[model samples]
Target: MSSIAEQDLADRRARAIQQLLHTPLLHRDTPSFDTIATSEQWLKEWFLRTCGWILIVDYRRGMARLRKVTGWIDSTHPQRSLRTGKSTFTIRKYVTFCLTAAALGEHGRSRISLQDIAVAVSDLSVRAKVSPFTDLDHKDRQALVDVLMLLSALRVVTELDRTGRDYSVDPTGNVLYEIDERRLGQLLVAPLPPARCSTWQQMAADPHPQPSSGAPLDAHRLRQHLMRRLLDQPLCYLSDLPDDDAAAVSDHTEHITQWLSEAGLALEIRADAWMVVNRRAGTARSLRDGSNVSNCALLVLPQLTAQPSGWISATHLATLVDELLDEYPWWARSLRNDRNRADAVATVLRSFDLIRPQSDGWRIMPAAWRWAARVDPACLPPSSSPIPTQPAQDDLFSVEPTHQ
Candidate 1:
């Protein structure tokens, strides 16, 4: 094959993997079809080897799904709003989302008008004894529309005429949509049916049986799995692995780097850490640090690193966050007075494996020290000596975002 041809093939493969990591689900209407169609098979095998499961590609429906399975615990991240800053959602919104889904399922028709959906949603909410939107203000109705827009984005309901915003403005009738039944089912990608588990705690527990210690470990397979994870995830900690696997990964750092290079990815290896620096194949990254929660994480990272024992309790961390909020009230106004600040921060930390909840409190992970190093004064440009006081409108989770 020509050199250019090989590079093109490699670029396509990298894009496929990147999309799978970034998007919770991929549908045909989106531009990701190119990657999903050309590289589906390769992605399926790669995910199976790395994550212990395969991708679900519904060719007839034009969908590619990836079920995020972590240690058999089935708590996926909350469905965040694409437009909302830090994607905040109230419990009412959550309940409304489920009720709307049930309403759609019971509607039985492929097409429904927005007015009809509103009536259905109102009826469902009343049946559940939740607050009715019969007397909703502009903001409250917008929240309901946000949930519907999220569903539209996921291809659960195809807007036939009017947009979600229009529905929010006046949900009396007019907006039409066609329901994608398969896509609705795709939204919940749990490994087991809800009937099998009763409580959230039971669902959170590892469902798989532990492997026997006497079973033979395939050295090559172990190395392959480690390499795939190093490339796929933001970071892989030794503390999360078995002793033998951890030792094997640490010993084969050089081989892993070489393998990454062959696949056109740059690697950064440390004593107790490894990460992908860049992709030479020019594929876009999936993990981005541009949310309000992420900004909070960055602001508090230096304080966490300065601790003598390199550990801090969740209570202390929350106190630190309170201090930061007081110092910069306009920074993340969404979280400043919000009661869920701790939960939001914990969610961000858990996503990056930056902290662990122990008997005493949360333990800072080694990989998070990189954030501290990044904030060093020496790393700043001469013109930008001090952190700017005037927050940019483009700042992630900014109080007044320039873009809606």
Candidate 2:
């Protein structure tokens, strides 16, 4: 690209970002540097908690991206291990694409279709660049299906959504298996797929967490309401806040702003005061005016809970995560009882408004861990009293909660 063209693209991106920020209040125009630092730190910690040590690290960015690695034994596994280019940072080569495509399909974190891999790798010879078989153009899908078969045979992965609902047709006239993610960790060597948690179910079971609806309307109640409100959209401004809201936030505005800012929610700086909104709606909110905060807040749940403004703070967050971890021991595989681990967990909990920080400890926010427990009773520790219902009301990643 020419320098002028590159500059134009950069300028366009800058304009787009500025426009995105415009959706925030004037005071919320920019994040305080502390929040930025906290977010970056939290992202890194989140990856490490799940990936262990082999994650891709960016020292400059202080972050890492994880790759799923499957470990299966076969007469072929040994052979491939001995041979050149058996595994890679990516799914590789043309001839090997039969296996490669399946690995990408079933195990890939990114939602790459078989054809997405085939087109990108067709011309290259390296493990990183080889394409799937493309003869007769449409026949490549059998190769992908064959690859999944190989994976199944090798125990690298298994197919889920067995109704065969997620298949994509390969160019070669064959229908390929859409790789299932639930049991993907069964394919890996050391690290495993992070277990998905059901927030609603857990909340439903928690003695500490109150009802999903109807509350004394304390800080916790406020957070629960906020999370529920976000089901419809991103944020709610304080000035325009509902009077009937029993769930008010921290009495102090500055601390509340800092806490939400540290967590995933951000405050838009307006001419008068800052504002807060759900981060997922960050993209949408970025495009609209601050007037949309209420709508967005109302949009996020019962799909996902929103953190009330009352519960905010990096320090308090650390403790809340510790408590949640204590309550849910199954995820203990991912949690270590160390300080950094605590810090990382706190940051994410903070993002979701599950907790707020005090000078020395975390204060559990209005959100409930029982939600996940209620949704997935199997998640409770074996010794604990059995929950009466299935906790998994919906898939973790899908938009099922929206329909709720």
Candidate 3:
């Protein structure tokens, strides 16, 4: 081999050695079956959660921890996992995510639940539009539980408590399982840095100030702010962002999209506006009125129009008014007549990159206008805020933002 190739191999070996030695689960061989493999996977998952990523464990990118503790692996020869199974023969993705999130200690208590997992999984399977759902039986549920129990036997996780959910009427209701995270940190203390794309630097090309970790607010708004920041362009979307983060929009959008059809939103590729229809529960008026769904519609709608083609005339476009009215009939009745309402909504839409104007009418941006809108409205220079008349200052802080 070339010297460079040899050196590269040696470097990888050294790093792998460092990873094993530094991580809590050091190389230690032991006898384990399917249950054992499940347990190890749980432990590794927990390690990930403790470090700040919530990943579901079931059928995903096909990662399986085939064996724990391969013995005497060295540069010359790689160690092979002793035990192999024909099928993956392990826990589902949802259970793994719960295990890992629970392993993050108290920080994860709110989100880790059987209902959450089921909803998340069902939603993912549904949104992905890939299931008949009739085939899974009680045996399937038990089999999943058995895998978790196996994880416990392998000393991968400790069960803190268990509670039954009553679905007594028919098939199944709900079940809650609780897990402990005391051991996950053994693997988490010195985790490696995330992949290059997962960094904040990747999102913010502008050197705008970062939010303090302690920033206070509602989770969704925070997520919206982040969505605006990270997803500034056409190709950028939450699916393109991290699934785990304090930002509410990213997390909630990802969470809901898994259950709600990506089709549920009324975003047509042609229109720059986003519309939401009732997936469930609308008042007789709402079915016709479309308001409560409207608030949510407004909240989520701006997200759809990422790339606006041109200027939109509010006078010409009564559709926004009608849609808003349908979503919030009561509020719409009151707000429609407000003098500055159209301009206000238009400005906000512009900030959100939802709308633009063409030669004649309003146009929608197919890609998100989110990134350009990342700056908080409060951060906008005031009317009284002097424009830097000086050419250099004006040039430096120009309204035109580079896509970088």
* Top of the candidates by lDDT: 1
| Stronger candidate by TM-score (1 vs 2) | 1
Q: Tell me the spans in candidate 2 whose CA falls farther than 4 Å from its real position.
A: 1-209, 217-233, 237-247, 250-252, 260-285, 288-404
Q: Over the full model, what C-alpha lDDT does candidate 3 score relative to the true structure?
A: 0.35
Model 3, 1-404: lDDT tens per residue? 99998665434332332232222232224212222234445534432322222222222321222112211111211111123211233324334334433333434653254445444544444544544122145544443444445445434444554455532222344445544343333322112322434653453332222345644445543433332332122122333333444333423545333222221211111112222222322111121223332332243234333214334455634455455444444444444665555544444444434455556555654433432332222222234433211111112121332110
Q: Show where candidate 1 strays beyond 4 Å.
A: 28-32, 57-62, 72-77, 90-92, 118-143, 162-174, 192-208, 212-233, 242-277, 280-300, 312-350, 356-362, 375-404
State which candidate has the highest TM-score: 1
- Give the per-residue lDDT digits (tens) of candidate 1, residues 169-264: 664535688999888876765545566888655655545533577342466556555664664465776656677666677566666666555445
lDDT of 2 by residue, 1-404 (tens): 99998665434333322222332111122332223233434434432332222333333422222332222111211122212222211232225544464446434563444445454334332443544344344334444444445555443334432432323342432233344343233333232232333443432232333346644455544554443233223333343344445224434334444434433455443321223544433333321232222112111121233333333345444444455455445544434344565454444444444334665655543332323323433334564633333334323223212100
If the candidates were sorted by their lDDT against the true structure, best first, what order would they fall in?
1, 2, 3
Computed on alpha carbons, the lDDT of every model, listed in order, comes to 0.65, 0.37, 0.35
Provide the lDDT at 329 for model 2: 57
lDDT of 3 at 274: 21
Report the candidate with higher lDDT, 1 versus 2. Answer: 1
TM-score of each: 0.66, 0.24, 0.22
Look at candidate 1 and give me any clashing residue pairs: none
